[model samples]
Target chain A: MKILAIISEFNPFHNGHKYLLERAKELSDCDAVLCIMSGGFTQRGDMCIMDKYTRAKHAVSGGADCVIQLPAPFAVAPAEIFAKGAIKILLSIPEVSALAFGCESGDEYEFFKAAELFIDESDNFKTIINKKLSEGESYIKSYAEAFEACGGNRDIVTNPNNILGFEYCKAILRAGADIDILPVKRVGAGFGDGELKDNYSSASAIRNNLTDIRISDNIPPYVYNDLKYSADLRGFHSFLRYSLFRAEPKDMQRIIGCGEGLENKLKSLENNNIEKIIENATTKRYSSSRIKRILCANALGLYADDTQNFLGADLYIKPLAVKKTRANEILAALSKSVYPVITDANGKGLSAEGEQCFDKDRYEFAVYNHINGTDKKDYMVLV
Target chain B: MKILAIISEFNPFHNGHKYLLERAKELSDCDAVLCIMSGGFTQRGDMCIMDKYTRAKHAVSGGADCVIQLPAPFAVAPAEIFAKGAIKILLSIPEVSALAFGCESGDEYEFFKAAELFIDESDNFKTIINKKLSEGESYIKSYAEAFEACGGNRDIVTNPNNILGFEYCKAILRAGADIDILPVKRVGAGFGDGELKDNYSSASAIRNNLTDIRISDNIPPYVYNDLKYSADLRGFHSFLRYSLFRAEPKDMQRIIGCGEGLENKLKSLENNNIEKIIENATTKRYSSSRIKRILCANALGLYADDTQNFLGADLYIKPLAVKKTRANEILAALSKSVYPVITDANGKGLSAEGEQCFDKDRYEFAVYNHINGTDKKDYMVLV
Candidate 1:
């Protein structure tokens, strides 16, 4: 009863994600694959092109045995926090023997070394990072510089997938998790690539050309059907504008990631063209991704204290979809989990901490449902 | 130098509004007509069908010599507060000698009697009203019943315009302002009428049938052109849904109108259709209009303390438009106002109290502009 866990967004469950799932299962020699997918929003702070349940169903159809939702506070967050939440959930399951991830650099040894350097946070490395940060460099840039200075590969630390992969390793070590690491090399298009290349197109490429007929060749048939009524960040510009306009500076200060007068900066932005507003708010210290995460947090009213409470509390496993044939096995394995397993959307029998996280997740989904004008219930998908 | 003041919403300056203006001017025998109109929202807690600047331009084109904006906190409020804010603005100006309003009864003596009773708040009347409220009647209904019991005409107290006219009288007495009251008889259609009749149609009727060519016969040609790009509450459904979904019970409690656990009721509602949500939230204790006002206040994040502060502070005179022929005369008259006159949208040289209200007004307009995707400047519209 060995389960290999993968952390992913699965924004649309495309060919590239299917390939990685299959590769990871083969490499880890696991009985089943469990995916911890971002629920309503992605790490880049954009709402998923498709809702989480539909994406979970597509994941099961593609190859995964089960798909569990990563709550929005973690889903639409920085790499470290995202990895921390997913790793915490995977560690709670006693049967999860290995954690797999897709990355540009397949060298697990380099990842472990980088993860160690970050975990220890030596005084010298901290001093260098702080100096770079003081000079107004972005956090990622400062981290990469400090990693290179400390005799680590800057390329491995700077690449998006590799950064997330190492953050997962750091979280696993920090949590004292007894699991194996499996790194699968990403194929075809790069992480940031926005064009279809063969059958393994990036999710962004598919999303940008969602209406293009060629997209049918990239995603599963079910995913294509689900995407017919998908939503995007642009569709929520009015909501974002209203949220930002209504929030005072003090209110903005309470939102996660809005610090150091960022509230004033965001409030000063012109309320026209979401892209232009984001572009104007981006600075050397605050990357576009960071600003976007802040904007999404503000729109959803995700407070900093609430997110911190969620991070400090134990996570509950809430599966979005399970393969029909493997549902019994997955449920049996999850029964031995140290954390609570939420089988119902009403979230009965949850601890206070778990209830807080579950409530936020429900609220985020409610907003998504409202925007799409759908009453799609949060029932578990069987495929 | 005599100036006749009218407090209006004029969601769209229709034939009825034009008739009222002419009749009020004739009754007051004043040299100029001054209209203090709601800015972005109306008393019923809905966004105006057109932007305030465009509506002000239409008002000037119809008959008003000057149109001053009523800030959002007071604009989307109950009759008593709405009248209080408008009267305060009118009282600040030295030249405004008479306040005129359209009413069904058109009896100045009756309005004065009702105003005196409300201002006095006799213990017997209070006990009756409280008992009715305790029995689950709405505030308006309870007030009407109590007025009828106290030897007042129930019809006069219940009629929308007459109620507002009496409230205006009450506000004038409370402020001890030296202004005369003039009641103008309404014609053609009733205040709540939803159909076009002859040339004088209610603003709601014109709004409900905006695309109908018959509306052109009810409103002026310029207003018809503005209706081509008008916005309604339906257009703001997404923003409202998003705001409510994201707000916590505590956050809803702070909104001006969401009191007595109404926040919990609102938060518990299904976030589907805006109209359906409001309908479901309505009860004997909360009328449809009250719930709509609460929703609008929640959407705009209008807090109770902030609104109370605005009410207590002296209101500023911010004219949205002025007839080109009467610009000099109106500006000269406004110069003698005890409250500050804000000619610039940037609101320079304003007191702290004035600045807070002005900031809220700008934020509300920014949300409106964001929804319409227009950048119409707030310059004075000279007709």
Candidate 2:
């Protein structure tokens, strides 16, 4: 019995995630599927409109064998760390044969090439890259230049999903895991776009559409219930709210990427204008795009110094569904597997440790929700 | 008439401000008082906890001839901008004689000495300060060292009020204003220590001590109505509940001061780990004390880029005691003033043109209140 492992935020479990799930099953040709879900926060630096458990239930209802948690930190982090953290949990499932993800590149050939260059850090490329950076070019621009110098194509680097996909590929390579990647072209609208068109619209667009009644076509059924349920979870936006109230100018100067003299410039603010302070503090010396990320991280209580290598038991098998007729077959396979399988997150298996782990993750996700401007009731989850 | 200009947040007219008011009166012997109050933000880089109108009312109730807004940008700024912004406003008030402030070295003589040295920015002292700052020492430390090196035998830099007092003097000298200095000793608990002793308690300590109690000895009688009247204006901790729910690792980077690549670290988190994120993110490079401020600022929607310049007005005073005899005194003052003053911010004063300006100021102040962890209602108010 081949088991497919998928990690997701689901947030509201829109068409994008739904499409990915269906495609994963088709490609892996697995009898059963496993999913590790994010509790509240998503990778894009905003709160999930829905709670993880509700989204998990949807995953099971929509078509999955089992559902577990990917935790909030891994869920909201950048593509590389997110992939590494999630993969760590998936690799533990002894029966899991493949790890599937939606890749923008449609194929792994170029993705792997880019990943190798980034990780290997070729000396010839580094010299040129450093020169561009010393000229006060943005890091993103510098990296883009490096990719060009290496004769790599630009189309792959410019796409958001492609970038993340490359990082995901690198993560798998670094892990030296046996699990294979099932790369597929993403079939959805891009993130942060204002409108929702096809069934698979971007999460940002879907959320924006959700605010008005007109965008219902973009979301799945029961999304309202899920949104209402997760309304109290207190996402990252609320964390920004908290951070704004508690921080001081002198204190703000200490965050990484804040830069020297930037604090003094920020300190020069007169209004309660957070955006202005950031604009004034950010200059050619520091790209606004990079600074924005650091600022968002600080607002959401995410920063660089907190790196950790703690990987709990390698395999985390969470059954989303168990056919009553085939229970015996699944049970036999579970018993013979070398990795531990978590049948019940609240009871047996990893429930004891998982419960404690999940609580902390949920709390942070709640703050993320608030900072993203979701209503208070919108963040709380029924689960 | 000789008028004394005072800059303040007056965030609820606490006793600390009252002490400063009385001291300014006695020291300057000014005929009138002109207070430049921050509308939305404060020096701590957070929003004010109350609306500017209510705060202005409290200021007027506590005692002031006129109250003008410091404007949003200057209100939420650091000490230098905050000081400079307020100074410009006070000096613009033609009747102003001097600026009175409270300092740790309640002794005027010592404060003046520090102020004189600080304003001179002598070559020798500047060199010493530059040398110390280059070594990564804190500005406070650098200032103290430089002051001593300048042949000034004062070690009052660590004192919060004295430090501000010196900056205020510096701002005056820099502006070449005719205003003199009136320094009074602080007679309250220190800032952010959470200590409470009789009537002498820091605002932070008072708030902490009042945690669950409806009323406390520390709160003034006049401001009691405000606490009683306002409905559930969520506090910073409560907002954190909302923020964590929405924010992702990337969102944390958007807040001012989240640094050290901590955003990526927090992205690895799961639910309910807000406290852990704070603990993990803080280190030798980032202190918990500073992080708290950043967290608060983020929650309030106050960003470094949003800083504004008030030009001169900090607030447009609206008298709360219209029925009392003080109304005549206030009305008389408003009629003769060059800048327009509002009696009712919401009802009579908010014309289309006035509304535009008021909205801008109120919007900025609202953001500030978010940072200060105070409940704000009715963008424009009658106070």
Candidate 3:
């Protein structure tokens, strides 16, 4: 079963994502496309516009054959951890022959080369990066500066998709995975663009104009229907504020990515607006995205040691949705994979470690349901 | 100065509360009426209908000469702890010659007798109470049964005000405070009554009929105006849900009043509704009020040890509001009291223990403001 696995957030399963899935399948010539998608939260530290199951159903409806969850610990994380976690999950399936990703740069070789440059860190590179970090630059900014200093293309480190794609390459190389890298160039408004474009709009643009009729053309029909009751950071402001207020600095320090007095910084914020708090907490050393991820981690109770154990533990394949016509074949193939496929919502046959990882996903969904005041159950979406 | 200190929630400072204050002053013939009020939360384990500062202003408007806060650790606690903390605060003030409380019985001697019975526990009484508790009765129910079996009036244990009055007497006796007990008869509606009477009603009734025009007659005009923007438990459902979702069983166990595996009971609930969660968690052993207090403690992150320290520590006279005409006199009196009067919001001039208590109050107010989406600063309301 030649499966082409794609790592995505598919926050709303927009036209751009549809194009990537279709192109990746065509380019890889695989029998089926499997999507390892972020559940409840996106990598950029925002709740998915729609619930994971609905979004997975939309993914199957759009183009994918199966969609498995990228549990919250990794889903609501930085690019490095997010890519590593997703790549590790994909690599656990022995039948996964190729890993496809959407990137601004279509050249896979450049991503691999940049990955190698980051992997084989020289003394000079380390010193320069450390110096830049000490000067209070963001991790990404410091890395970009260091990469440029080491005669690497800074664009690959700066562009969001390119950065993710580079991290994917790094993870694959570090793990010595035999899967092929398939980079399908993103064709639309850029990843961070908030303005709608003709036919192919970025997910951000679609989310910004979710209530606008114009977004109807940018997302699938099912997605368009589900987007009406989408969730966002603003909807979660009260919970976030309460979480911050209740958490002492020591409690917050246990959260993943909350370190170097970030907990104290967050606790000291007095703004009621979520955006304002984020803006106030963001600094040269701590990016706004970093702050958002910390806030999301705090909300989900993603502890540092727990997340570390989750990353170190064996991967679990929990499919959120699969195409009805291909469900048996996908399940049968997944059953034979190295990782345990968790089909039951209660984690019937999962190992202890696997159950712990799956519980985080369940907890994240529970929080999402709570914030939206919905009782949506966790079930595999069958199209 | 013969100051009469009343322990009250004054959730909205309804007509019933106003009547109690007036009658307590007239009955006691005290120089001034000092109110030791619950801040942000009530003993029933619910968020106060209004912020402490606003409620204090309403208390002053309704005839309180001075109002001091009963910190949240005690404010949202069980009757025993609540009464003890409030009594300790009043005892610290040398001018507070008497502690007044509204009760159904209004007989101070009867309350003292009941208090004596509870304090002087016998082996038979203990065995009966333990047997009733083991048979799955609530603490109050068990205590009432044991009291009845020991030739004590069960009515004093069953009635809400009588229960509180009894606890106040017990606290006074335990502390050996020189303050006299002044029990004022409750008027109009009962404590748990949901219907409004002619002009006096329970705080619960006013809260239930907040938007109804009839409630305007039940509360002061300023209170009526402030009631329009009142905060309630329903408004805090998101925060509570998030708190429950983020908290592990161990974390919940550390919360004050969360014990006997109640944390597990709360954590196992899959419901999104706060009311439903409380109802489901409530059993024969745990009353609904107990469950509510646990939920409130969890939301405020009030740990068991911290609250224990707070109860054992020296009291801090943090005035929420004071009648302008008597402000100077009250301030002068309080400054000379045994406890340090914290006039600053920042907890300056406070002992480490006092600051810790004040921080909890500040945190509770912060959570209240976050839930209400308001940035109301904590200030001593004067009118």
Candidate with maximal TM-score: 3
Residue pairs in clash, model 3: none
User: Over the stretch B1-383, how does candidate 1's per-residue lDDT look in tens digits?
Assistant: 99999999898899888988988887777899999999887888888888899899999999999999988888878888888888888888989999988888847777877888888879999999999999999888899899878877776778887889989999998988878899888888988799877688888888788778888889888888877778746557766776677677887787766879888888777456688879988997788898888888777767778878887886688999999987998989998998878876788777788888998888788778766657778777788
Q: Which consecutive 10 residues in model 3 chain A have the weakest lDDT in total?
A: A232-241
Question: Per-residue CA lDDT of candidate 2, range A43-77, in tens?
Answer: 65455666555676677766766666675546556
Worst 10 residues of 3 chain B by lDDT: B231-240
Q: Which one wins by lDDT: 2 or 3?
A: 3
- Candidate 1's TM-score reads 0.79
| Candidates in descending lDDT order | 1, 3, 2
| Local accuracy of candidate 3 as per-residue lDDT tens digits, A257-367 | 787888887877744567888999998777888898888788777777877787788768889999999999999888877778886578776767778888888888888
After TM-score superposition, the amount by which residue A243's alpha carbon in candidate 1 deviates from its true location, in angstroms, is 2.7
DockQ of each: 0.28, 0.07, 0.27
- Please give the fraction of native interface contacts (Cα pairs under 8 Å between A and B) kept by each candidate: 0.31, 0.12, 0.28
Q: Indicate which candidate wins on DockQ.
A: 1
Q: Tell me the alpha-carbon RMSD of every candidate.
A: 5.8, 18.5, 5.6
Residue pairs with backbone atoms closer than 3 Å in model 1 (clashes)? none
